[model samples]
Target: MIGTLDKAKLKERYDICIVGSGPSGMTLAAELAYSGLKIAMIESGSFKRSSLAEELKEVQSEKLPIKANSRERVVGGASSTWGGLSALLDPADLAHWPLSFDELLPYLKAAAKYHFPSLETFQNPSGTGWKFKNLADKLFVAVRPPFNFTSLVNIFNRKGVDLYTEATVAKLVSQNGRIKKVLCRSVDGQGFEVSAEIFILACGGIENSRLLLVSGLGNEYDQVGRYFMNHPKGYAGRLHLSKPLPVNNYYLPRVVGGRMVYAGLRLEEELQKEKGLLNACVQFEPDLGIFQKYAFAIWRRMPGFSTKVLTIFLPRTLRARWFADMEPRAENRVILSDKLDRFGSPLPKVVYDLSERDKATLEELFSQLRSGVERLELGKLTGTAADVLKVVKDDASHHLGGTRMGLSPQESVVNTECRVHSSENLYVVGGSVFPSAGCASPTMTMVALSIRLAEHVKSKLASKPRRTFKNQTSRTSSQKILIIGAGNRVRGDVLPVLESLPGFEITGIFARHASSLFGAHRSYDVRTMESLSVENLKGARFLYVSVPRETLAQVLSDLPGASSLEVIIDTPVLPAVKKYAHKFKRIHVAEDSVFLPWLDGLKGREVKEIECSQSVFRYHGMALVKAFGPINYGYRLGNKLYLKAGNTKVKIIEPRDYASGKLKIDGQEPDLTAIIAELIPEERGLLGEIKSTDTIVSKMGELKRVGLRRLLLAASRGEETWSLEEGLNDVRIDWLLHKVWIYLSI
Candidate 1:
């Protein structure tokens, strides 16, 4: 009764309560704000100028990332301060999205019309080739996503949109599983209630999940607050052209139907298949520093830097990075945190880690891109693949998941219409409804879906007077079961797998560097034999071992505890490891041999080999813990490698990149003093026990008695099933042989 009549002043109830004032939310609000059906649009942040002024204040104070880049609170949500990179999601992502492209085509076009009246002005891109006779101009630059729809919400708000700024929803009022009202709070500590026939959760991905978790309706799938994903994006390698290109790569057009100006890259599906890594989609990013410098340079040379010629001439000579989209599996996800926010609502604690397959896919993707540019006459490539290293995995405060929409209630959180299955009148309108964060940006696609949803809702609102259509006492949108997974790809195989996921939780990717003979060193090798732990397989539902055939068991014997399924994508040897086939989900038949010769070269290369332990990486004397949560698990400390050469005779080192430590031997360090453990002592690690107990068993007599090598291997396996007794039976065999036969043969 309190929630029902809380709107004492208003006798009439609204048809919808639209949350958020960002691109998607604003369009929905603008479309129905003046439809005369009674609508209550809410905004978490106020649009007042005071907030906008505060933005530049941080420009000099560390120049933190933008709101869309990091911060979330401000007027108009993130849209108020976006770069206007309204790049429509790639066709591949749209095709793979939960909602169909055909279904969203009209709505997308409508959204463009509704929000962007001046949209045609920036339709096409035009620019001229750059002349790089100078050192700065010689760098090769490419295209990236754009920022055009900047003042978007303001455009709609000026058109009679009922505005409610600084309004935060505390809880959703429910009656018989349907939302009856929204409990809202003002910045001034005042409270209000909005009664609506429909409710849309448009508070961005993170906030949307926060609302769900806060409202106490998220315990069902364990999938609710899981699979929090992001592109794990970063500025990677560049195309340092031998000669500069025609135009600058960062020019965004100001006016219509411009050539869809974007630098492009392709996923090498052929190679990725051998690794069991799914290729979602791939993209290219232009150098921002180059863009900034060039623009400023023009402004300095010619004070009036706003000339059309300047725009046309500077986009060519710059560096670019290519991005590959990854697969959507159950392991990558969002989970809830016990931490509360200013509003007392729990903040969404995101736990997203990547799998070995994701890293392998990324490594393969970059190699293909590099090879395409160098050998295939694509372009002149610059920088070692290692130069393109950094990855930002903890974001998507832009993308999120958990409440995935699938064909069945058992698999998804919502139905086809972006409605939660367990609740009524509630529809997720922001990127939160997106099951997967494909390689592309999600705004355009989400906006298109909201528009379609709005019309569907409008049609169903005939009111009590027109009870014929309502004769059945139809349940709310929350009760409707939507067919989420049925969709078609506009560009199917040509696009990456990430492009194919929609309304599904594909989370972004797990990234790592690929080992190269003339390039960068590797992190781990699963060939001959490899050891790892269960905890190390965190956030993983899929495992693809790319090692030598003979060593398949050496690597996979301990992996069963990490994931229910294991796939052997490629191996160095064959037939030997093939015998253990019955234990794995599938085996990738190797028709190509890029990995074979590479295995032969492992003897000379320094790579980290890993195993499992209770502690992953130690920092400040604290051990990183791991356990299964909503959707994914955490990473464990697997054994890493350390070189025993040069002055560094026995200094411990991390295996993959072979990053040396401060404890270098350099003559001062003792020989044979280095030791690497995959697990913590007491938890199965041989070195762990030594390190923890202050007991160093270095004598040969002690080694024989304790079965040191085998015991260490078992610790690396990190699963009780392997029994601390026999984890390294395979590893010790190689030791007996003194040198491996296959190692010499290759």
Candidate 2:
């Protein structure tokens, strides 16, 4: 379909000219192309020659990522090489933006349809789980949250949008505050020039801003390249699950027809308070053995001169990368150089920088992570012990706001609607309009805004005197799936249902479609309830739900008239006591479990030694605290403490209790999770001290150092009680190691 020719051919004017073929650009094109808008899309890469090698290179002839992110500079843009995970920008991610979250929710659903196509994905993830079901034994700690984004770009093609790969935009030819024409060309020096009533910028967060700076537009505020963002992802390091796998390590697929297939455990928040900053996300990959076998097979099928067996080596190590986000400082920006590319456009010059704030966030996130690893008993102290943390070689590349949108011209490059402040009709679209860097990925939000902008543009077009009909949003979906549990407008449960309902062949998005009265969070009146009935529970292949509720009697009384269906839920509450407990065909949950994937240090346990006079374990005999009625004594241990939940032998001690033998095993209780919570007190706690299975198997030195440092920092900084028990001991790294090694070796 790429028939246009002539390197310098100039078409006076047309409809729209969209640059870049990534999700933002492609989705925008889809919204406008079918309108019979004479669209001219310019891409820098050719569709026929797209390859993984070329896409991963990080630079094109030394040009950095078209602007900085790892956006695919191919025909389909980043979407061409994306992993296809499509989570909407969480409300938390958009919290700092000028627009209200409610404004974007509806659009997000529409965008979800294009990004995540599987009907199973459209329902609750707990319902349509992993592609492969049998490998779950080894991957014991995977929890796919409610909005685990997946790829579904094929849906865009079906909607009749035009695509141009390997082409690039050279410049925008504007007049009278409007984009009258676009100057574009291919990497091979071929050129194109066209015009449209509306122009969109969806190249990506990084590139969109670069394009603006390169085109020399909207520079009054010097904001064209500021506010750069990306979802900084980090990891807690290698996780070793409690269960045995077929091999040492392997990847598991989600259960057949289930929403949650992949699981990941984050450092509990309580621990993060102690750690400095590290917003981390770790992903598992196909196993090394499986990869090796696949490679050998590929070699057997297409052997090379080198035997090609070594290429089978795959990475199973859990990687930690820093999404401890970076803000776009004016100094950290994309500038234009005097040199132009073969296409006659000035190449973009980018300077990437990390502010102290950026580093601190990561430092804290990782700090808690270190403590967490100890508690989970996942891996040995290898990756994290080092000073500098290593990020995943491969990570989520969805770009975000570069030409950020803001309330005033001084703070942002684009106005609230993505329009260049002073220039009417000269609008910028895509992730580049975000005000703050989000912790979540940005594609779904890009699509959401695109649809909204498209409608605005359509309405503007329809308003013309000659226009015959107005384009209405089409919500007529054809697929159907069953929904369940905790969602809807009432009781403030709107988000989960809203995110899952819009796209599926939705038979209904409810707890039990057979009867909404039972377990219905949005039933306005309780007086209109019905008796619980299992007869209407048939025909559902998938189900979506929220955190499990303890009160089921109310639901049982108002049961609907449908049969059972597959189900997905947002919480980890297991199903033991239930009317349909035996019907656990393939249940899915949102968060990671505590036991499996054993990376959480507390997953197992570690013991620590303290100088406190009150003995934690003199011979594992006397109750230390009870024996010494009152003494100024306390020792530190990891969260995976030797004591069981509520084990009486364990005693907790604080500085205030220096004279009393009293110590709270937990802040006031016990439990592996609880201890970890008290030690780190972060998003997910890291430090865990414990009484052990054998003679105090301890990582003593590490504990003393972390504990000391934590205590000092907390006390000197602002801890209420000047005691060592409340935190990590931050001593010289080597010193900490020496102490632990000496004790353990002895």
Candidate 3:
């Protein structure tokens, strides 16, 4: 099922755990559907692009110009933002690979079928067969609509896999030279472990190396994070033809089988082999007028309104855009930077540069392409070889070759099967495993490798007897609960906490506005209800209410009085519980502060005194009073209130507004994630003082709020909980605080 890792409890183990949900990971998972091997696909990013994901992927690029958004950190990886340019690697690109072109052709065809608009769209056009004057056609195909792999959400259910988004794998734990488990943490800082029989790293080219370096794995012979590559792309030169010789044949996009096909020119593979040159491809685009160029730029930034404007405008000249593959150099690599991300993992430092041969290849390809156009009497090219040499270089967003696959450990990180050479049950996929990159888009080739890996794994598993796994039906079965609100509190906290636990199915949601109802349609399935009907609430034993005061009153008054019904209302709406207590069988006012990690240390302990200083006296004082009770006397000195309890001293310091961005830790600007990490040691210290698990301390406030799980479990068993009397007493303390405040002001 598709659920976020922060809110979903993953199974303890799986047959395989893939660490990325990119094109490669998604393809591999889909290919293994119905294989009877349970899978867990963990994605560091959420379904959308998030700031945390962006920050986590921060890279220190030394030479290659890698933009901040060059590599997408989302469910579909870079495919989410890509233009859907699809093509296969040239056969010469596989020269350094352990496997040959013929062996990989089937998977390539399968990938093309899966990604292309149609199978026929991938076939080359007839006649000279795209070969003329020692130049061949490099096909570029674009689907009618881009193929975003995240649309494969249903595969989770069909494949019996659990897709966990917003979960970042921290380290791979190895035992006896094999990966044993992975320690993962949600972006919100909830840490957990996932163990599996096999582990695959498909977290992109740079990330594959960074993870290996961080985990101290697969670096034998110091080849784990070396030989990084990206297609160096730029406008090499401008070609001014003698005549406008059918520019449509080169510049215009051809509509073929529901796809836009562009035939780019490249050096013949045989010629490249003969000259010992790198793979290079160049496509021609007609230069636009000043107004048209400006319009195009604006349209690119704001795509909704520029298409018609561009169609009305026309171009003036044609130019050559070059994309050349870089030679894999041992010095070009991704290493762990000393700088840490919010998760405390080292950032990837990329030391990448194009080789002299790389530049010469581009120059040579441009010269040959210009020579052919002139030989064909198309036009006399204007831009010279000097212009080609000065081509402004930028990364093509095609990150490849770190942890490259090959035949030996000394030269590669993975073998022909994409398995790590030194470690069994560990495999690598994606462009990271490409021993050589062609001057084509890498996504299609990566998909092929992923499919190949799936077949290899399937054969490896076929020989071994299948192991029986424990059924998880009992944990996720049909105990129903209906949510009564669709506000931030309900969507952000209530639904996630309740959904994380077992034995509860959210049946439906109730909201006044259609927008609110639409907002509640999260990863899981939940029908939106018009009103609280008998049919909607048929099996629901509990109702979670977190609306405003008026809405709570209306909802509580309208509730059906079944003895099985229980109400868990927010603490602010305690008066609603008092008014409607008799209508429901049980009521629990959720005061999450009582379950906070700091407060958990005070539970069941005698407090001698309490020192409180803060605004929001009702909320703050109630938390302290509820946790440590039976105050004999209270004294106010200055701004602080001192309370006498039994013997233990309780100090509630002036709470800092962490969200206001004013708090600082160790002279550094306040970052919520960093502050949370810093507080873990102190939270652990608090746990040491109390009888509590460290897991709760690890999640800090999130799990503390999730302590609502206990109340729900108690309600399920018809056990005792914070009763109406105690809830009223808690409110009375707030009432007393109000009276005291009025008196003091007067």
Candidate 4:
């Protein structure tokens, strides 16, 4: 349902919360809706453009020129001002990516299909029609109307999806390494909160980095706002043909299969790689105006010459425009300014610098292009290198590379899954996550990555055990289970699955209200805390506690003979609960992050060494233990933890060091799958060595004090650890301790 931000009417919780209703955010919302997960999308603007909202987009640029209409803050984002040009990133451009072209091809194809449903083919011819060795001929450029959310109005209205317009997320609230809530405010300055299981920042390139910086989120590697890039474009020259040549509609936008398509010139990928030159493309348009009219008048005076001129030479008076790639440089960056917006958020200060390589690349490319045209006798290029430089503009409105993707947190803001390095559930999607921007319009690539991200989210949701209704006419003597806390997780994640099983039935539920239990079976009795007694717990074979951590101990203590029953806690047990460990015969704490399926292979394989390079704050320790086995001995070397059992060795490197390219195992680069494998088995044994009141306080304090980025920097420099009182408060430390216990127990 599309509505204004009304905290009173909004649901208290959602499965996913997406910030910014741009192409990437909307595409992800549509893709994830198929899975039936409740989604909430928050946009800063409404359907129509607003001066107030647009004012927030104001940015100060240094060196590079900022386009006045570069970004839109409305419902559709930049799509509102986009000139739909679809093209894929060159394979050579993705050399640094962990994902290969083959891996990304399906998503790219899907994105193409989404944009052009009737697209028959995308293949371009090998060489330009002009016979020149270096001249690039047929370049694939698909033209379609800019993507607008209005086109997906019906999709946005889908059930379980809530889109809040004019609601801007100002900051993210983190607790125990998870984003628990988002503080949002309207343009009118009304404030509210939206909580969700997973949070995604799809608020364009500039805003993406800006929000993270203000919230002190994913900047662990100091790479969040760096490597800013844009496709530098300018007038190359004019083409004067030696002979009248027939120019086809391929050079111009023409309707084909009910969609607009155009073909331009791209330096072949092989040629660019061979020459060690950057990717660049050029397009030609007939130089129309007074010159064309006068030429036509002169040509009409000679019938024979006029026929040739009308057929070919008229189309030869073409203007050339060049688009070239910009190398990713650290100096080109976006940072927060001292000035604040109306909402009190810092305005982004973009510092863009065109490198010497960029200038040389353009000069070399146009020179080659001029030679190619002249050599083929196709045309004579007019305009010197100086003219090209003078007319060039850095405002393609293609803002890219702020929250780039890399293998580790130190190298980039997000991981391969697009999840933030320090936070497990936080993700960022859009051009901001691009590690490098090739000389192609970013819309196509952004859409493809959004599709991939949607799939990943869906898979993660599917991996969690949720409720599924089943019909059963007969009931037999089965195990009776008592459940506490009638919240979303119990009702949505536990009840349905439990009811579907033939051998189990929910005997009782302890919650504030019975009506809150969704699809509640009549046979099950619901009771409040005061009314509950030992008689209700008698004969119940299994007791499941899904209550808040604070009340868990009280709830467990209230039940008599609790030691006789099997207890399963939804959350990780606290260290304080160890004193009551003897009360329950078998205590099981659910650890959702652990995937048992990943351990399908390697039963007796002789594994050498395992290296886990993950964010220390968001590490999956228990899952590691279950995957590997028992650890015999372990020690810490600086920020890395090393554990060994017989022949296999496990190393847990700090996330920043991993991203800085410091962690290596057996001379091999860090692999997440392999590292987690080694790190998991040794988790249980190593847990005791690393577990301490001071250590836990120190880590959490570091996370809060400097944020993940600065915390990593301090750890790398071997800075002094914070004291318990100076560290995270007792409540947060208690939460951290419980998480550690969960990992150790698992």
Tens digits of per-residue lDDT for model 2, 373-469: 5565544323552332344222346456568788788888777777888677777887778776544455666768887887776666664433122
Q: Which stretches of candidate 2 lie over 4 Å from their true place?
A: 5-12, 34-38, 50-69, 115-124, 127-167, 186-191, 231-236, 241-260, 263-279, 283-323, 373-382, 385-396, 465-746
Residue-level lDDT tens digits of model 4 in 1-746:
66677867575688899999888887787677546677889999877788888787889888887786888988878887676667667676788566787887788776643452222345632222455566554444443334454344333433457788889888999988899989999778999899999999999989899999998988867888988888877766888777644444455434444244455666666767787766666776567656755753453233334433444545657778777677888888899999998889899988997787776667776787787877777758898877776666758888998888888877788888889999989999999888877777788778888989999888877865433323231264356777887654564445544533445667778864332232222223345656667876777766777887777777777666665666666434554544554776655554332332223333465557756565333233323332455545455555666655446776666553322323233545433334234533212211111212222222222112112122222222334322112121222322433444211212
Q: What is the lDDT of residue 24 in candidate 1?
A: 68
RMSD in order of candidates: 28.9, 27.8, 13.8, 29.1
Off by over 4 Å in 4: 117-120, 124-128, 137-140, 244-249, 290-314, 463-746
Candidate maximizing lDDT: 3
Q: What are the lDDT scores of the predictions, listed in order?
A: 0.42, 0.43, 0.68, 0.64
Greater lDDT among 2 and 4 belongs to 4
Sort the predicted structures by TM-score, highest score first. 3, 4, 1, 2
Candidate 4 shows a clash count of 8
Backbone atom clashes (below 3 Å) for every candidate? 73, 118, 6, 8
Measured by TM-score, how close is model 4 to the native structure?
Answer: 0.59
List runs of model 3 lying over 4 Å from the truth: 6-8, 117-120, 126-132, 245-248, 291-316, 463-746
Highest TM-score: give the candidate number.
3
Winner by TM-score between candidate 4 and candidate 1: 4
Q: For candidate 1, lDDT tens digit of each residue in 1-746?
A: 00111235334566778776666676666455434455666766654444432332121101112123543555456655443334455444444466676666677666544332122322333443222211011111111122222223322221123456567777888888888988887665567887788888877766676677778664476556555455555455666555434434422322222223332443434443446554433343334564655753443333323334535443333454434354556665554556555556655555555555555656656666566556535456565545443452334335646666655556666787877878767887766666666555556666777777777677667552321211111222211111101011101110111111111122111111111010000011111112233343444333434333344566555445432333323312333454555764434322111111112223343433212121112210011011100101112222322112222122122322211222211223222223223222311211111213222222211222123223222222432222111223222222322233211111
